[model samples]
Every structure is written in C-alpha cells, then in structure tokens.
Target: MLSSVLRSLQSLTTHNNEHQECATPGSSTARDPRKQVLMSSTTFSGAGPSVGKRLNIDGDIPDPSHQLPALPSNLPPPNATYEHSTPPQIPKYINAYSLFLAGSIEMGAAITWQRHMAQFLHHLPLTICNPRRGHWDPDSRPQPSDANFRTQVEWELEALSNASVICFFFDVNTKSPVTMMELGLWAHSGKVIVCCGEGFWKGGNVKLVCERYGIPCVNDFAELVVEAKRMLKQKGLDAVTDEEIQRDEEWAKGIVARKARKEA
Candidate 1:
C-alpha cells in the first residue's frame, strides 16, 4: 500500500504541469502537495502546528506572540532527544549526532525497537530521527493526498538526508518493504548500518546488497548497536561527557523509584 501511494505521488509530480516552473527539477520538495516551498522551523518544537494539523499555505505572517514552545529540559534526555512528528515533554541538549532510525515501522505494529535503541544509547550524544508517530490510529486509511501523510514522508526524507548515521533493522515479523527501499537509497552513501535478522523474508537480498556496498550488516540487534557506537567513535563524533552519563543514571533511578512508589 505504501509503495502504491508513493508511486501515485510520483505520477502526480511527473504529470502535473501546473507547478513545474516553481519547483526545482529534482528537489525533494518537488512532490509537495502545494508544489511550492515548504518552510519548517529549526527548533525542536517546530515553528508551526504539529502533524495532522493544517499547513499554512497562504503567505500570512505568524503572530510574534504565538511562538511555538520548545520541549522542556527536565524530561529524560533520551526521551527529549529524539525527533518525532508531535512535540512532547523532553530535555534539551546540543552538539548531538543525528541517527535516523530507518526500518520496520510497520504502522506501529512492529515492536517499538526504536525506543529500545534509544534507551541503550541514551548516554551518547545523539538526536534520534524516529519516523514513528507519537499518536497513530491503525484503523485510519490515509490517502496519497492526505496532508499528514505527505508531511511525514517529507520529514523522513529530510531527516535521512541530514543524518550522520542511518540504522536499518529488518524485523523478521515484518515484510518491511519501506525499510528495504530506504536501505537501497542509503546503501551506497556509506552511512548505513543494518541489522537484518536471520528470518527476515529479504535477508538474502539484504546480505547481498550489504556485501556489494561494503556496508556493515549484522544478523543480531546487539551487534548493530556495537557497530553504530564504533562508527560514531571512529568518526570522532562519540564524545559523551561523564556528566551526561551520570544524569542518565539519576533519571533511571528516579523512574524506578516512582514506579516503586506507585506499586506500593
């Protein structure tokens, strides 16, 4: 279904002559719903409304007082660090490496492996570009023309392009066609680390591509994390202060204490 929707969107871009003059020939924004420039805020909370909200098509000026708030700094650093379509309470950090989590979303049906990855690497200075929506309704069937869907695709593309490292995890439980497509897109970019489980339907194909491209491919999730860390360190981008690790430890302890109190 995703592949079909992508095809339809591409077809529209190819045949729609109305906005040809305004769009860049091969730019990512060429397939925009409005076929015009898209302006997004650089801040974590975003400059405009959250995903699923209407985009500002008109050239109306935003009110100065109606500033989008930044995510707070007290929330767990790992929780606050990752990028999602919607804003939630999270801490603020800078000089972070961007790691695009590209694989096996499966419309929220796939296990929340991204969170696990985030937790394991919580102490590292990384901004996780997670594509999974904070709030998604599995029942709703979004069309190719849906604003939310377009926004999400654009967001993921931009994130992947900007990421320092892109990690792909092909879950055995999912067909993961989109993940396969993403792997193909970045395989030659020399910035990918893949974890294709033994039972994945496309494991053989993935292995062949990884071999051809000399991309790091691991059969286990744990190995992927290790490779990611090694890559970051080799690039001299894995600088994590002792303060950050201590902070994360304190946060974990607080979480455990809160859970214990609630249970008692």
Candidate 2:
C-alpha cells in the first residue's frame, strides 16, 4: 500500500511540473490563477482560507443550527455552483445548503441534465457541487496513472462528504458504473436521492438497492430536482441560524409558508 501511494505521489509531481511549465507567463497555454494554485504542487500544502489539510497525492479526496427564516415569496434564493478544481467551500452565508451532483457524465456525452437541475434549483439557498470539468477533453480516457483524473475523483469525493444532500441520476443512454458505485457508498447515509430512468441498463438493480435502503428514488430528471429540492429545504430549515432567520425573515417565512402549503 505504501509503495502504491509513493508511485501515485510521483505521478502527481510529474503532472504538476508539466502543468507549471506549460502555464509559464506569455505561454499560449496559460491557465488562470485558481487553476495554477490548485495544480501547484504534489504536496498540496498551499495555505489559504479555502485550502484545507493536505489530501494525499493519490487524490482520494460542516455543521449549523438556528431557527431559520421565511423565504420571501417571489424572491430568488441565493446559490452558487462550484465546478471541478474550484475550492470545495460553499459560500459562507447563513442558511446555505449544499447538493452534490452525482451520476451519468459519460465524457460529457450523456445529457447535460446537471445544468437543468442547477437552473431549476437556482432559486433556493443552495450550493451546487458539480464535478463536470469545464475544460476536459472527451477523448482523453482516464487512467489510474493520470493525476488529473485522480484529482477529479478526489474533488468529487470531497464534495460528496460536504454535501447535505446528494442527487444521483442514471441516464438511459450511458452506463454509469462509477455512479452505481457511489450509490452503493451513500445508499445508507440518508443523504441520497436517486433518479434512475426505466430505460437505464441497470435500472432494476438500482431500484432494488433504493428499495432495500429506503432511499428516495424517482424515475425521471424532473422528479429528481423536485425531490432534491425538498430534501435541501428541509435541511436548510433545520440548520439555518437565528441570525439568518432574522435577517431574511420574509424569505424565511416564505419558505415555511411554502412547506406548510405543501403539507396542507
């Protein structure tokens, strides 16, 4: 195990060196500052408010309480989307909720349903943990030795841990083996809501697991958003601070009103 970890660290060091050289000043391949810092060193020892304890180069890669507030009717909720390689911290705000998007992302070929879910839930106090790489190459198949691929996996795992809710979708067009594995990991955590389309190759197996675990399972994308939002709102109400409720009393009331009406 130690030997394998050393090898992965070495691989990460080499990848970082290459990235550094290519991103030199005046180079056409230069990346932005955040990207530079994120890929800075194999050690990942950078110190910053957002940067936390070092995750291994192998790239394996929060709580609150309060009365809550009423979400103002007709008011949009505060939200943000943290893409891959970005800092894992959700926006530091009262009543914030985090949702990790897990599911089919077959090299970006699978439907861009993530965007749809983000848009649909944008009106809530939520942060979307989206793992889709903004500049990924579809043809570059991921391998164990690829540091970038490992880093992406690390980010997703970290995001999943930070999430108050995780939404998984199985698109019928692709075989998402990784997503299936993720479901296995989080099925009993009570933080997952799955949407497996009927036409998916593993729909039956997925449904069986959901049933076994008593997970909230839906059959389509729309329902996934609906259920995920419901879970987020419930969590938000429980975790929002007294200050947040006072500051956004109207909005908080709106949230409570909406929930009451739904229950009614």
Candidate 3:
C-alpha cells in the first residue's frame, strides 16, 4: 500500500513538474490557474450561505460526503525512465515486532510481564498484545460465551497468528486453563516462547509440551524478557514505545489494582 501510494505520488510530482515546465514561457495551459493552485487547505467555492465562514485547514478538511480523487498531474520528461532500487533487505517496514503476550492473569502476572516489556524490552521496537493486561474486571468474570470474550479471543488468535512470537508467562497463582488451551492450539506452530515459573499449576505440562514441540521455554521473568527481546531483534524491527498502545480507563484500573496488590 505504501509503495503504491509513493509510486502515485512520484507520478503526480513528475506530471506537475512537466506542467510547470510547459508554462515556462507560452503554452495553452499557461493561462490555466487550476494547474497553479497547490492544494494547501480546504478550498470553498465562496458562492453560497457558508461563504462568510472560514473553512478549516486541519487534516485536508474531511469531505465525508464525496470521495476525493487523486488530482492528475502533467506528463513526465520524455527521456526519464523508471528506476527501481535493489530489493530491500527486509520485506517491508514493520511498525514493530508484534509479540502476542499470552498466559497467566493471577496476581497480575500479565501486568508483571507488561512491566518487564517496558523496563527491559521497552527500547526495542515491539508491541505486546495482551488483552487481559488491562481488561480484567475485579467485579465480574466474563463468560466465554460473552461477546466481549469471544471478540477478544478472536483478536488474540489473529494477533497470535500474525505476531513474530507468542510469549507465554505462567504465574503460579491460577491454573491458567485458557492459557493452556491456547498453548495446545499454537503448539504445532513454531511461534511460541513459554515461561513457566515455579509452582504454576501446569508448569510441568507446559514444559513437557515445549520440549515436545522444540520451543524455547524459560522459568524466570528476566529470562522471558531476554528471550522475547532476542526474538524481536532477530526480526530486524525498530523499537516502539507505549505511546502507540493507548491504555483505556479499564486498563488503567487494572494497573492500579495490580500496583495495590503488590503494595499489600
């Protein structure tokens, strides 16, 4: 999409340059002011009721009613030939190394994982996709049949499939039944990094599964952070910050609760 947009832009620029060149001394288009009009802000006809009002210059003046088409530019130089750069080392520009955060919510293990992501891997270009990190509700446990739950599951699955790696951290608190189920689902795929701390109910099974699948498994939080960073670096992506992922009120509440639990 970016490449196409760039190509269109290049074509348009070349066209405009030629148009400008044509109007150098004397040409039929020299008298045309439309060619000279560089679109800077929302242009109003100033013909009717809204004539007195100042049109907004922000963000191309959103025209919701009609779709704006790309303006045609003048033709390029007759001798100018197309040039392509040598193939990029990487396929394309990935915003970040997307690592889907999976596993444990007990005692806010997910929050701990998020913090580690910030403390250690924060400098790296990566995005941790953990739905439970901020959306956990203390008042009510949502059922699997709930629309939100189902939708979150769908989104997580999609992120898992698309992510560079699946980082699973098992807290010693809950059984992490859903996490285990997800482990099974993604077991065959080689995109998992399992971390099962001591006393986790399913630690043994998780390890065994990791061994069977030849996936990298760790037992410490620091180890998990290191491994996740290694994986992201190998993908050759730039480090992105938390500013990209906006935490909502619910997520903020979860963070507060996690902090309070730690303080207690």
1 against 3, candidate with superior lDDT = 1
**Per-residue lDDT over 107-158 for candidate 2, one digit per residue giving the tens place of the 0 to 100 score:** 3435556665666566555667777544442222245476656666677787
Candidate 2 lDDT score relative to the true structure: 0.56
> Regarding lDDT, does 2 or 3 come out ahead?
2
RMSD for all candidates, in order, please: 14.3, 14.5, 25.2
At residue 68, give the lDDT of candidate 2: 20
Q: lDDT tens digits, residues 103-127, model 1? A: 7654343555676666666655567
Task: Name the runs in model 1 displaced over 4 angstroms.
Answer: 1-93, 137-143, 240-264
Better of 1 and 2 by lDDT: 2
Each model's lDDT comes to 0.56, 0.56, 0.47
lDDT of 3 by residue, 167-193 (tens): 887655444555676677787787788
Ranking 1 against 2 by TM-score, winner: 1
Q: Each candidate's TM vs. the true structure?
A: 0.57, 0.56, 0.49
